[model samples]
Target chain A: MSVTTPTGFRAAGVTAGLKASGRPDVALVVNDGPSHAAAAVFTANRVEAAPVTWSRVAVADGRLDAVILNSGGANACTGPEGFADTHATAEHVAGALGVSSGDVLVCSTGLIGERLDMPVLLGGVDAAVAALSDTGGPDAATAIMTTDTVAKEVLVEGDGWCIGGMAKGAGMLAPSLATMLVVLTTDAALTAPELERALREACRLSFDRLDSDGCMSTNDTVALLSSGAASAQVDEAQFTDALTRACRDLAMQLLADAEGSHHDITIEVVGAATEDDALSVGRAVARNNLFKCAVFGGDPNWGRILAAVGTTDAAFDPRTLDVSINGVQVCRAMGVGDDRSGVDLSGRTVHVLVELHAGSEAATVWTNDLTHDYVHENSAYST
Target chain B: MSVTTPTGFRAAGVTAGLKASGRPDVALVVNDGPSHAAAAVFTANRVEAAPVTWSRVAVADGRLDAVILNSGGANACTGPEGFADTHATAEHVAGALGVSSGDVLVCSTGLIGERLDMPVLLGGVDAAVAALSDTGGPDAATAIMTTDTVAKEVLVEGDGWCIGGMAKGAGMLAPSLATMLVVLTTDAALTAPELERALREACRLSFDRLDSDGCMSTNDTVALLSSGAASAQVDEAQFTDALTRACRDLAMQLLADAEGSHHDITIEVVGAATEDDALSVGRAVARNNLFKCAVFGGDPNWGRILAAVGTTDAAFDPRTLDVSINGVQVCRAMGVGDDRSGVDLSGRTVHVLVELHAGSEAATVWTNDLTHDYVHENSAYST
Candidate 1:
């Protein structure tokens, strides 16, 4: 139970026959709330999908009664007709729920540059509404998956309130956001501004730090809705902490299931002048193909790591830098230190620690190793 | 006859016993000139190799008497010992040629973070100096190779003068320069400043635009030396054009021989507000792993192209963008246009043209497709 784990929420998933594989492809979640408060973030990419444009405006007034999502064809780059299709999708869902269309949000994912099959989608939406239940969160999560091997869900229980979230993503993951769709629900007494603040802060420290492939997408959305059914006024700090935990849990799940990835690597950048500098340095190393390939081969080639770090303008003395793989310090002061053969990388998780010795600030970024399956999976994705 | 195609220059290649494969690993080139004028460029990566640090200062006075290059170990990330090794090699060369130690430049390639075998290297340097002759250019071209499959050579002839060049590189190729070692010789009567101007312009248009893997190296150098043996001065513009052609030719050769690459991709961005904008957009697409994978799989996934273009800050309207793969306009006005099936990517060379429709300026960036072999080669490279 993810989105529906919170009180006053109902969800459903149904088959739409939109996918060639004939998988369940449509989902709906509704909030019956004493307080209708919402916050959302979409892809920063300029070429946004039709549903992203539609939902962005829908949540501008800080209210959302429902969210509808689908996984079959990304309704992106389909022009004006695509936007119209998104509007029609929300309108159809609103008509079934007896709510205004302006209070509904929409999301779509899959292959880009294609139109959705509206008749089939509407038929599935009708079925989903009829099958809505408080235990439908698992099905909803599964329905929104493209290449994901498993569904992701999280539930954080407070004293009298709770936060629940579900997410779906597989590939094309990067910083600024991954190619993912996420929905969160909370049964707590909170205003829209409060929810927005917590959501932004949580996402910045969680999803924004995951750089699986260094490829941003055109249809990434994360949203949260609140219902005052719990009638408990929780502290803002508590809410933010729970939300961050949920997002990070889901992000790690996404990293584990990233397409064709063999290793989940965590790059911890310490001793920086600023958090931004640490992030910049971490991202540079995370995106370096040479470094990623070395990790995949389990080669402790610390020189590639230093070469990557040197590409950034972060505050660090090159001669004073240090790097460690796992628990072994392979490079000391930018030179070979301990024996590389002592460090083992034949595991699923790898840790790389970089000490800049610039200051006290630090940041961590998560990524995956480059592998043959990564190339094969992506190369044959659309085909 | 690449470097020796011009007059008043001698070069030689010798076995250094540095590489495990027993390949010729040492090369020497000297200017037996009436006028010795030189200009050189090194990698912009801040974590530079010891040879790069030494050569950059050696050519600062715009006069180079000789250059010594070695393969099998890049003296990088080896600390003060690496710098000392480079200095000792240059001094040895200077002693043998009866020139100032400061007038000799050094270059090294292969694996980083390792020390050179001084006794073996010094003996090979002696052999290289004694074996140096005007007809030794071919052997010199073959010596400074890391993973390169073929030697790169170019010769441009003028009315009374000629320019010749040779280069070696294969993987770890990217913008800001590839992991390459280059030597260019000219028999024309030119000054140091004029040669610098021409060399800069030539590199800016050619080597700078080739970004094979988006991984900048710690050691990349291109040096141009003028012997002034022909005693005939050519127009600066003409010399620049000839040098640009030679650089472009070598750059394309590098692209063709890039490790594990299946296709050579040319991303052309047109109708931008400025040339910089065009290049910015082109490089964005060139470095996008998703787009590169699509090309390797022979999939005309134009949506990935538009998605990559949207990530840039270049001047462009998202809705007005157009993309064509080969001769087929697969996307128009940022939507599906001609059928994607009409585009063919079965050939070795693939062209992707993007029309921003923001202005008239344009630029092109060259890259290689991501393939399984590329992953295989790089993953097991240092192992």
Candidate 2:
């Protein structure tokens, strides 16, 4: 169980013949609820996909009955025709589910500059609706993948209600939103505005700090749907906490399964004057390709770390900065500390700590190292 | 002939036993001038090298008699000991050349966070001064290389005056101050302010646009020395043009030799609302790891280019932007224009033109594709 782990949700995935690989390419999640409330966040990239445009308007009224996602085509940069395709797909979903077209959301992921195979995708929507089951969550998760080697799904149980989510991405990941497609569901009774606030706060700390490749996708979208079937009136704080936990779990899974990643890096920036400064400092180091490559090679290159930190306008004195890797203080007071050869980097998880000596604020950013496989995976062709 | 092409300049490079390879590790360039007017730029990185700290103050009065550079140790992040080494080296150079220590500029480039070997480096400084010759520019050029495959030296002839320079940098190259150590010599009659204006303008257009790996270095410095020995009165425009040409020549050489990169990419942004916007757009694309990897794999992935452009705040309508790779308009009006398969990437020189369709402003950025060799070179132990 994934999204359906939260009650009053039915999901399905079916082959649409949209991908050349003949894999399942379409998925649907229906909110069969006494209350249908939803909120969504989209990629800030000015070049948004056609489905993102349709879904943005659909979620504006804060009521969504169903979300239809296709994995074969991004439906981005396809001009007016692409928008029409997304509109038609949403209308088809609404007609099949006996709801208004505006109540249905649409999402797409794949190549950026191509139109969707509308006929196959629409037919697959019919099959997906017919196959919607409470236990179809696993298939739905698998349907959204492009370059991902594994499906990402998470469930966080509250006192009585639960939050669950599924995400798919591998490359084109950076800040503001690491490139990915995500869908979250909860059984707790809540309004659309509450869900919006909770989802925004959750994503800001979870998905927004993952800089895998420093590439932002044009079709990135994350949506949250809630149904009051459980009748569990959860507290606002509890709801946000559970939602954030689910999103973080899914985000960590995505990082672990990032394409061609050899090491998962956690960059922790402490002693910042503000949260934004900490985030900026962490993200700068996270996105530094040279630093990432050094981590991949198991080279404890702290100079690259400080160089990355120097590029940011974060509050910190360069001469007073300190760095520790895996609990070994490699750089102290902006100078050499421990012997680099003593630090062990043969594990999959690499932790880098930077002390700015500015204030009490701190933030952590997750990233992956640059490797030959990363180049090979990204440079082969468009997904 | 390189820096020695200009009159009133003597340069020498000698082995200092500081490098394990016993290669020439010390270099000295002296301005034997009636007018010792000079100007220089240092890395904007807050964590600057000890030599950058010393040279910045030495050139503050806009006059310098000599510059001493070493290649085996950067003398950066070594705290007080590193600063002490730089101070001692400068004093030794000033004593040998019979000039005040304040008139001697010092530069060091190699592994950061390590102090230079004082005895060997100072001895090489003495040997460098004894061996100074009018035609030793090539030797001085060879002495400053770290990871560079070849020495980079260029001379540009003005109406009556000539501008010559030598540059050394193969990695950690980025905007504002492309990571490198450069020495420029001109025998034209000019004041310190004239030399400063010309050098700044030249670097802004040339070196400032080369973003190799999106990593800034702690030891980047570019110095311009005017001896006023040619007795030639050159026009300001001619002098700036010649200086720009020389810098551009050395900048290109750095790109060509940029740490195992196979393709030299020139990203030109046209029809922007402002030059800064154009540069921002081009640099965003140049620094995108996904796009660079695609270029390295010989894949014509135009989607990666647009995705990078979308990340910037540059002025452009994503729906109206156009991209041409190697003269093939692969993306037009933000949609697929030509068959990506038609774009040939077999050559070493790759040209990507992005049209913002906003206004008349244009800018160009030179970069290299992310390759396996870049990973291998950077992942290995520090050179």
lDDT of 2 by residue, A104-222 (tens): 98989988777788889999999999999999888999999888888889999988889888899998888768889999998899999999999999999999999888889998899
Candidate DockQ values, in order, are: 0.78, 0.72
The C-alpha stretches of model 1 lying farther than 4 A from their native spots are none
Top DockQ hit: 1
Question: iRMS of each prediction in angstroms?
Answer: 0.9, 1.5
Query: Which 10-residue window in model 2 chain B sums to the lowest lDDT?
Result: B374-383
Candidate 1 residue lDDT tens string, B46-96: 889999999999999999999999998999888888999999999999999
For candidate 2, the clash count comes to 0
**Residue B75, candidate 2: C-alpha displacement in angstroms:** 1.4
Name the runs in model 2 displaced over 4 angstroms. none
